[model samples]
Target: MPLVSVRQNWIVLLVFVALVLGIGMVVGLVAAPGTYVRELKMPDLVLPDAVSGILGLVLSVAFAIAGWRTWVIDSNSTEMRLWLATLILSWWFSPAFFIMRMPALALCIVAALFVLMVWFEFRTWRRDRPSFWLMSPSVVYIAYVAAMTAAIVAMN
Candidate 1:
């Protein structure tokens, strides 16, 4: 790889950003209600919902940025293949877990997904010197996933 040729692709970056924003909006619309206590009623509903929505938005954006960075920079980097696969799997699992309405199963899936994400981050960090701009989003994403998994497990 020539130093001069490693030019950043703004178009790809923008598309990735768009994907994150779009997915964030969709996830919020679909999964926002589930944040509240379902089986056991919580004392305060409004705060939970608001907090959840903000969390959702933040996670959604984080995922979007991570995906875009992965795609744009490591478009064909084999080192990133595992991370890419896990990210896609996590995304797919989300819908499946929710559609089935099985919190226990969703928890399992999310837990595994979080592990994979951690692995992905580890691999990425080791293979390349990703900037804070790239690494921060991935960290936030994993945290969000963990929080969501906890919330869902509690519901179950």
Candidate 2:
């Protein structure tokens, strides 16, 4: 099979990233004031807004690093592209999970994402050791997902 041209692939990736971030920024702005509304009736919790925001930032950086590595260092292999697509689609659901406070559904989605992470790890481990670096964000994200799930379960 003929290889994909790097020029075309890079442009596509860049456009994808730009669109994701642009939508994210708009959502963030609209949702900024309502961070506490959903939990109004519940007891005051230790999970601070700043802390959640920081976590979001960390996730974003990790994702950007993984994307950069994928585009700059990895070849345009089918496996790599599949992993990228799954990661982005899964990530698109993440903020909504938090915004909606739908912890049960969030847990389910993150669990699926965790499975995807494991699959990605299995696929790339022997072939590319640095794939773990790309997959590290999943670790942090899974941790957060678990915590949020626990919190939601406890509140119910």
Candidate 3:
């Protein structure tokens, strides 16, 4: 059962958005995207930092919407929890490499995130198809991200 009335669940969506944007801000403050990333030999197809950041924001909102949709449908469902975990992992991808300066570790984290995200997508295929498709874009973007990270790990 939902812990709160269905009408009140919009708050959770805001929370997800704030939590994600806040994490991004904190990471920005600490990492600052200066010499650390620019000096590294990036992949040929690597996205510019500005473009990647914009996509990250867009993906974050996508995740928030998917999570909100799932939570409204069934707050206690296992898929809701899985979506939450996936969202958390999504927030950590950039930080794992950019902030901590661990490309290999970040690559591993992305691999795990990719697996978890795909699992979540499959889990929602029947449970909530819209939510499934809501998250579909991230799957492709994440694969691109993982390839880019893997290349960075190789080059560095």
Candidate 4:
């Protein structure tokens, strides 16, 4: 059996979006006003928070598209699970970095995760050449993370 049907994939994606929005609303309204201000002190050269957020959202959508394509082509592949897990973990790294105020640690974690993602993508591509393009969004995400890390380092 497939990991998730096409319809189920859409449902999961919708649910993920809803969860993110709900969390955002809670953080914006319920959390202390200065919560984020205290946690994230980014340099001016880095993109503004809103712009970086939008970029992350766009990149996430791209990853979703890639995941959907992978599901359509071969939902049973183990790589699909790895792709999904990597997506979820990628979502965590930003909060983990900014909220924890540990750029060096976060950079190390991100680097490790990037290596793992690349390895998974390579395995998937080797097993199924047709799905090679699915890796592009993952690469973009890694690049984004790297840029963020560099900006954080430059700030100090």
Candidate 5:
């Protein structure tokens, strides 16, 4: 198998970020007409709940795939366990944030999950020296989650 380098992993991370942002913009545009946008004074921006669920679903899938790929590449039992936990926790975050309408609590939960993911990746990197690409996805995920949380909190 071809060895994946840190640079390659960074490229992958950038691609994933682009994909997530692109999807979000597309979804926002498509759902905009039906969405009720609330203007926030602090950030001077509009918040819409219309595509929140869809964005959540997209992020969940991306995280799952990233976790699965990392697990597969590392072949570590601990990594596998962490990936499963992240996947399950992430899957629940969307509904809790959007459907239950508890953005703050949901953000906390997801933040914890992101921390866990980073710890897992760090451990795997130390033990197995897997490509940085394996860990980059977690970084991207965390950034995305943080941005969403900021938007949610600002809107509220």
Candidate 6:
């Protein structure tokens, strides 16, 4: 592995960022919100589209870096794999709700992600207390979205 001197792990971090953003963009475009989304009875807490977009991008990138951090700590650790699962499921959330127009399915996916978020926080609390606290925004965002999705499911 000497020949692969692309050291400092920048390559790995870039790969994670690219993968998260790339898949996210593709899914978002493909699942571009339609009448179904507008027709749903959205929760009062829902933010404006621009605000949501900015917040979403921030959270998504934050999660990507978090995943990369896990890999850096121990690429083979179950924690890293859990982060990967969380990212993949998060990416699919839009498609499930916007593309497939299945609020119920989306709710389930989000619920699973929320559970994973809790597990992740518990795991990180021991190793990196700051990171656990840093993830508060992410946890709140997921919970807020989950609530919104549930509202949609119940409304229509």
Angstrom error at residue 140, model 2? 2.6
| TM-scores, one per candidate | 0.65, 0.62, 0.86, 0.62, 0.54, 0.89
Flag regions of model 1 displaced more than 4 Å: 1-8, 31-37, 40-47, 92-98, 131-133, 136-156
Q: Which residue segments of model 2 deviate by more than 4 Å?
A: 1-20, 30-47, 72-78, 91-101
Which tens-of-lDDT digit does each residue in 1-156 have in candidate 6? Answer: 011122688789789888988898898888889787777887787789899899988877777777777777777877777777788888778888988888899999999999988888888777655446656688999999899889888878
Minimum summed lDDT over a 10-residue window in model 6 is located at 1-10
TM-score of 2: 0.62
The parts of candidate 5 lying over 4 Å away from their true place are 1-66, 69-76
Count backbone clashes in candidate 6: 0
Error of 5 at 56 (Å): 8.3
For candidate 2, write residues 1-156 as lDDT tens digits. 123354757666565466545665666775453655466444354367788778766665555445544555555864467567655656545454557766567667766667766766666666555545656666666656666665665676
List model 3 lDDT by residue over 1-156, tens digit each. 223344777788788678767886776677566678878998789877799789888987887778888888888988888887876776676677878888898899889888988998888898888788888998889888899989998898
RMSD of each: 4.4, 5.2, 3.1, 4.9, 7.7, 4.1
- Window of ten residues with lowest summed lDDT in model 1: 37-46
Q: Can you give the lDDT of residue 148 in candidate 1?
A: 66
Clashing pairs in 4: none
Residue 104 lDDT in candidate 4 = 75
- What C-alpha lDDT do the candidate models reach, one value each? 0.56, 0.59, 0.80, 0.62, 0.57, 0.80
Q: State how far residue 150 of model 1 sits from its true place (Å).
A: 4.7
Off by over 4 Å in 3: 1-8
Q: What is candidate 1's CA lDDT for residue 41?
A: 30
Q: Give the Cα-based TM-score of candidate 4 against the true structure.
A: 0.62
lDDT of 6: 0.80
Stronger candidate by lDDT (2 vs 4): 4
- Checking candidate 1 for backbone clashes, the offending pairs are none
